[model samples]
Target: MAAAWHRLWPVLALGTALLLAGCDEIGLKSSLSPQPRPASLRVVPPTPVAPSAQSLDLARYYHKVQNDLLTRGLLRTDGGGPDTPYSADDLARNFEKIVFYNEYSSGDGLSPAQRLQSGQLSRWSGPVRIGTEFGASVPPDQRSRDQAQIDHYAGRLARITGHAIAPVRNGANFHVLVVGEDDRDFLRRRLQQVIPGIGPAELDLFSNLPRSYYCLVIAVSGAHNPNDYTRAVALIRTEHPDLVRLSCVHEELAQGLGLSNDSPYARPSIFNDDDEFALLTSHDELLLKMLYDPRLKQGMTADQARPLTTAIARELMGQQPQDPI
Candidate 1:
């Protein structure tokens, strides 16, 4: 197990795939908007070091946050039973909302989700090679456990979407970083080395990340073809509790692939901001299947995908493809 330990420096936020929270939604690449300047990455080999006091405090705070959320009956992990049922129409509508909507308006930093409905279908046109990186502060055992979770989840996503998704150690197009607060300075430098053109304002997004926000993702696509994603990254805080950390994994990694927005009406779904479901629900799996269905191609508008998704949703639920809602 390899890790990069930080020197207890400050932080930075790079731009790419959209995030689940405000930070991600602001400038994450999507078919809905003009692509950001094309950027590439250079791997920063892992280094071992100790964590700072603030990182430890952040860990304790997140544990408390997780416990409080559980106490309030949030962050469910049951995959949603009958009480949270959705309809064929619901499924199709939710799929459109999740795929074709934008969270914040035009911006450079984190902001409240504006629900700007302007996104288009965008997914990796090629294989998705997922690579996991950890901060030095993370214990070796925890790193192993986290890597296991990502590996299994990648397999689940592959099975559902029938896409080439797997954990890799080289030539990865999607990078998932599990870092703590104290490692911010190192991260800033690392990303600066990886994405040399990353702006100061963008870096401040990480340097001054709000405590309310936990994790985010960034993606890159060709300027001419917004639908085709090439490179991406997901930032998952190591401080969160087990389930919450897993929740970040499920949501952000999926978001990095394509599903870029959230909808209030999406029941039993991780795509919803309500936090009712901690993990990807059965409903989410069906959505993934529908997303990769050959009928609905990338760069498709919601209007372009509506009829096709409805029909696909029917087939997924064992109903006749042409059945009326």
Candidate 2:
């Protein structure tokens, strides 16, 4: 029995050594043993920046101006005033004429001479005129305000287009007064009235105004009738196709008169496509805002600024076709 035990002892010792080695490979001892902990990681959150007062003021100013301009006419409480309500038909007709020019010039980018006849050219270069017949009840203040807005937009237009736009005095130019429900309808009627003499050819409403000024009458009152506003813009484009490239009125005014449209802070590009709205990258918005700032207006021409503007515009637009007008 002692001889058998001695032989088995060697086997038992070897087996115990093998089990210990396997435990080391499998980390069983480490699993069972107490261990020291690693140091804690420190993480800090980013700080936020507040917007400046100047930025807030400019935003507020823009909002107030737009609201004032939009609500000018409708806010009047006096019952019997100049009614400028226009029918959809009037708008459609004016739209049709304006759209004709939009299509004509944009078709293959025709020259003004090729696109417009002598008659069309005559009307465009002649005067900035408005024809309106008010009901005896319309207030004088309302009339003045309506005219003022036109003159304001016209002056802005002139500054942008390098043309001198002045408002002709009452009864000095062709004033066609159509008795209508409101200014919108009156404008439509006036436009229709003018189309026969001016011919059906499209005029660049923006470009063709007399270097001086002209007025059109609206019997309906509200902020410049958007229908009239749009039609007038279309008419301006019809008469002067060159203005189409100068789309944004704010940018156009700033750039045309040698003002800076760029800013230091990040902002969305004015030339951005409607489709790209919220998808703009921060870098791209920063680039656009810089270009649109008024302070940067110095020593820049439209030609020089166009490439940078276009690049940022395209980036904002993403992988899409260029915007149509």
Candidate 3:
């Protein structure tokens, strides 16, 4: 399956809805409005409670969901191979679409629009501190596994972007909440603190997220500088199986770093909505590296960054196109 790795791209936020052309079997493509918990900075476990009927049902549903995706050979983790070989042009084009455009309308902040609109580049201009909180129903083992994966991923992100990124317990602006159906109230209370003055419409997502949305992330920037993300929150549904949950982590957390949109042409990568890759691929790593390359400043438009992206992609791919740039 070298055409590409399998993916399960979830709606990370208002940042972008890259594409909704495919992968609806699991509804992997989303255009929700956004998160940060690199992992377990405080590790506060919710009060233990019996699993509610909704929680149990959700668990079963997600169990079947992951099974179906696997059966279809989706969520591939191999990164990609010869059959999925891509050119520098492919990289640059995908980068332009994913990094410079967004899915959904920001005008309403609540409506999920299926439109692809141009947007400025957004990313963390400062250190990214991630912390995690889990619901009571989450077992200790699951917590440990999720935290370990996030920590490892945080390190990997820092290495890839040459930026300061880490999972912390204190002073975390990025909060990752792992909750289930039973934790709706807990999540509601927490969301108030995590996102002050959140609107009722957006509130519905955290308190009563739809089954269609497997996971979600919200990356927010200060009013003075929308390109510089200051805070984020990602909701990973505990109902999902381990692989799906981790896939949510990978896509959402990375999306929090500013790759907000999904592109259909982005093969050999998780940036596509094809559900072909479960993990970030070698192709995606180059996008991250190029994103934080220092030359592409925050708030850059697609046109402003195109030349640089092409150069970066060419260098990363070691390919020279016959056509002039």
Q: Rate the local accuracy (lDDT) of all candidates.
A: 0.70, 0.24, 0.72
What's the CA error at residue 85 for candidate 1, in Å? 1.1
Q: Compared with the true structure, what per-residue lDDT tens digits does model 1 show for residues 76-164?
A: 99999989988888999888877776655454244444546466687888899998888776777778899999989999999999999
Q: Provide the lDDT at 261 for model 2.
A: 16
Task: Write candidate 3's Cα lDDT for 1-325 as tens digits.
Answer: 1122234333333323232211211112122223443445344566666777888898888788778878998888999988798888998999888787755554343344566667677788989998888888788888899899988999999999999999987877788888888878778877767656555655675676667666777676655565677777888888788988888888888888878777779998777766778888999998899889888899788988888788878878877644464
Best by lDDT: 3
Structural RMSD, model 2: 37.0
Q: Which ten residues in a row have the lowest lDDT in candidate 3?
A: 20-29
Which model, 1 or 3, shows the larger lDDT?
3
Superior candidate under TM-score, 1 versus 2: 1
TM-score, one value per model: 0.85, 0.24, 0.85
Q: After superposition, how far is residue 233 of candidate 2 from its true place, in Å?
A: 10
Runs in model 2 lying further than 4 Å from the true structure: 1-138, 170-193, 197-325
